[model samples]
Structures are given as C-alpha cells and as structure tokens.
Target: MLIQYRRDIADLQQRIRNRRLQTFGLFGTPIALVATVAAGVGSKVVFWLHTEMPNPIVNTFTASAFILIAASVVQFWAEIGGEVWDDSGTSVRDLKLDLALAEERHILEARRHTAPTADRQASYKERLPPEIVRLRMESRHYRRLHLLMQWLLFISSAAISAVTAWYDPPQPAKGVLIGLGFTVTVITAATGYFKPRERAFNLQQTADAIEQHATAIELGIAPYNAPEEARNLELFATTVEGMRADQRMREQQLDQPQQGQQQVI
Candidate 1:
C-alpha cells in the first residue's frame, strides 16, 4: 500500500538533489568561476605573448584582461539568483511533503508495538543476542568500506568528466587526459565486477532488519510478545538469521550478469 509513497519519496530525493545542483550552477558557476579563471588565465596568456613576441605591448593586454575580469565580477553579482518565490509543481515546499508522508508511514508501523519506554528499550539492547552484535559490527565494517570506495570512484569519475569537458583538441593535456580516462575506466570496471556498493547496501539492509526485530522484541510487539523469554529469543534469532540469509541471496544476485539483475530482488 505504501509502495507508491516510497517511490514518490525516492523521486523527490533525486529531484531535490538535481534542483540543488542547478541552483548552485546558476548561483556560482557562470559569473564567479569565469571571473576567477579569466583573471588568472588572462595574465598567463599575456606573459606568453610577451615571451614569444616582444613587439606586442604587455601593458595594453594586461589592462584589457583586468577590465574583462572586472566586468565578469560585476555581472556575476547582478544576476546571482532566480525568482525568490517558486510556484512550480515540483517546488521544494511540495517536495518536502514526501518526508511528512514517510513520517506518517513510520507512525503507522510504530503503532503495532506495545508502548515502549526509553529506559526499557535501553535495557533490552543490553541483553541483545551476541550473534546480532557480531552481525551489526560486520555490517558497519562493510558499510564503511563501501562508502569510502564509492566516494573515491565518484570523485575520480567526476574529475575525469570535468577535465575532459574543459580539454580541447591539440593540447598539452592529452597525455594527462588519457591517463585519467584509463584509470577511471579500470576503476569503474573493477567496481562493477566486485559490486562493493551493492554489498554495502545489502549489509546495511540486514543490519536495519536486525535492529527492527530487536525493537519489536524490546517493545513486546507481536510474535516477540510470547509468554516465554527463551521462546522469544529463539524466534528473534531465527527471524534475524532468515533476514541475513535473504541479504546473502541479494549479494549473490549482484554477482550475476546485468540481464539477470532485472529480476525482482
């Protein structure tokens, strides 16, 4: 029933990210970056001209560069922002409603549990199964490793894209560009084969499952509300292991070919 709301939330998050990037580009990229780059590059070009042809007047070229840079700076500040009030369908105000919907969904889930007190919950965590503790630690390690590798890949790829975009034909940066392009390609291929991101997500999902079950046990939620504590622990552990088994299956799916990845996970 809530799948549509989840999809809406995901879409909203993506749109929000894209909108923020666009806003940053409009605010900072055009005027400020151009002004800054022009000021530095113009001086270098003028110096090169003087070195190659002493007949050219360096002072005139320098003055023109300064004026051009100043103009860019002035123009940058003049048109820095767009309309203050947005009336679009996808405005930020509308996007935030997804968050409210998510909170409502959570409230519905929470209603299933017995009224759990903070103190009791903390005590319950203390008596959590040792196996879960180990699983949680393992999940954290996998999650952190994946996070680091993903950032490295993303940063490297984005750097290559920016460099490639800026590079023109017949330039000295050809060798550097080739090296970076090759490195990014190799890293991308390795990442895709190994599936570090998917592994991390699977591990994290398992961790969340464990935590949710633990919460149910702590709060005396259904099934965990059994009369015998031993039976409840047995059920909890069984449920957690089943969740981990599902996680392992997902990891195996990641190893399969792209065509196989289309099947429901």
Candidate 2:
C-alpha cells in the first residue's frame, strides 16, 4: 500500500510538471513570440505609416497594430493571473500529506511484521530511518533546483542587459530586448515568490527532527528509555505521529494565502 501511495504521488507530481510544460508550450512561448515580433516590427510599422504609406491605408494599419498590442497585453495579464498553469483542481499540499501517510503506514506494517520474535526486531529497527533519509534527499534535490533556477535567471538578465547597453541595438531590436527582459523578470519573480528554497528547508528540518527521535528510541536513550521493548515501541510510534503532525502544521502554514492575494483554486 505504501509503495502504491508513493507511485500515485509520483504520478501526480509528474502530471503537474507536464501540465506546466504544456502551459508554457501552448501559451507562454507563443505569447512571448508574438510580443517580441510586435515589438520588433513596431518602429518600422510606425515609420511606414507616417512617411511611406498612403493616407488611405493608415487607418487599417493602425487598427491592426492596436489589436495585436491589445491581445498581447491580455495574454500577459492572464499568465500573471495564473490562468495558464492552474493545478487542474488538486491541492499539492494534500497530495504531499497523503504520501507522508503512506510512508507512515509502511513503517507500521514493517513493525508488525517483525514483532513476533526478538531476532526479527532488526528488520523493524531498519525500516523508518531510510524513509527519513529519502525525505532529506528529496529536500536537497529541490534546494539544488531552486538555486540553479535563481542563477540561470540572474545570468540571463545580466547578459541581456549588458548586450543591449554595449552593442547599442537598433530601435526595433531594443523593443524586442525589452520585452524579453520583462518576460525573464516575470519568471524570476514568480519563482522567488513561490519560495521553493524555503519549502526544501522546512522538509529537511522535519526529516531531521524525526530521524533524531527515531535514533534516540533505537538507542534506548533519554525520553525513549522505557524499560520494556513494547513500551519503547509505543514511544516510537507516538514520536512518529507527533513528528508528522508538526510537519503537517508547517505545510499548512506554507499553504496559507498571502495578504491581499486570493488562492487560485
């Protein structure tokens, strides 16, 4: 059952990732391209209208330009409002909790399976720490990804700014660069605002706390130094429950809506 739960959570995460990619492919890239093209052609279009075009065609050209700009603005607003990558009616935090519950169930099963004999206690002892280790590793993975995205955005922004300043690009190219910069800024700001780094840190901290409690119980140390093996096992179970509760609280806090910002739902 725990394995099935893990698989389900993995599937859900993958679906979310794929949906985000699809959103980018269908809406993000095309809208950005349209905006860039409009920017690059804007100066020439204006020049042609004022100096080269016949007066009779000016109204039609102006109307077309206006429509393109208006459409681009609407697309940009939609992206900002999260219409492009909405989670398709699932709570990410709830999915994570479900995964955690699955892990807990697996641990309990391991304990029960090994409970019949003294010699088999080793199997039960070996069960939970590995799950904590996996959680820590997952947290580290997210931390690394968040850092990589931050660096990439920083480098891209700096490179774009430097090239524009040093090369003194034409007016149309300048407009395109400005649009690209705006897109990059939006991406960076969104990434930072979501705070993947903080999420990773919180996950790691919870794993560490759980692992410490488990270790103390295993070693027959303070707070878990119950005389009977059964009592110690009970302490271990309750410790895990308490740790999970703490973790859930932290996740709930993370999921809370920021002031003045309604949840996307």
Q: In model 1, what lDDT does residue 254 have?
A: 82
Local distance difference test scores for all models:
0.66, 0.68
Tens-digit per-residue lDDT, 78-137, candidate 2: 546657545533445655665676667767866665546544444555677777888799
Query: What TM-score goes with each of the models?
Result: 0.42, 0.49
| Model 1 misplaced stretches (Cα beyond 4 Å) | 1-130, 161-171, 261-265
Best by TM-score: 2
In model 1, the clashing pairs are: none
Give the residue spans of candidate 2 off by over 4 A: 1-126, 169-172, 260-265
Clashing pairs in 2: none
Indicate the residue-level lDDT of 80 in model 2: 63
Give each model's clash number.
0, 0
TM-score of 2: 0.49
Displacement of the residue 242 alpha carbon in candidate 1, Å: 1.5
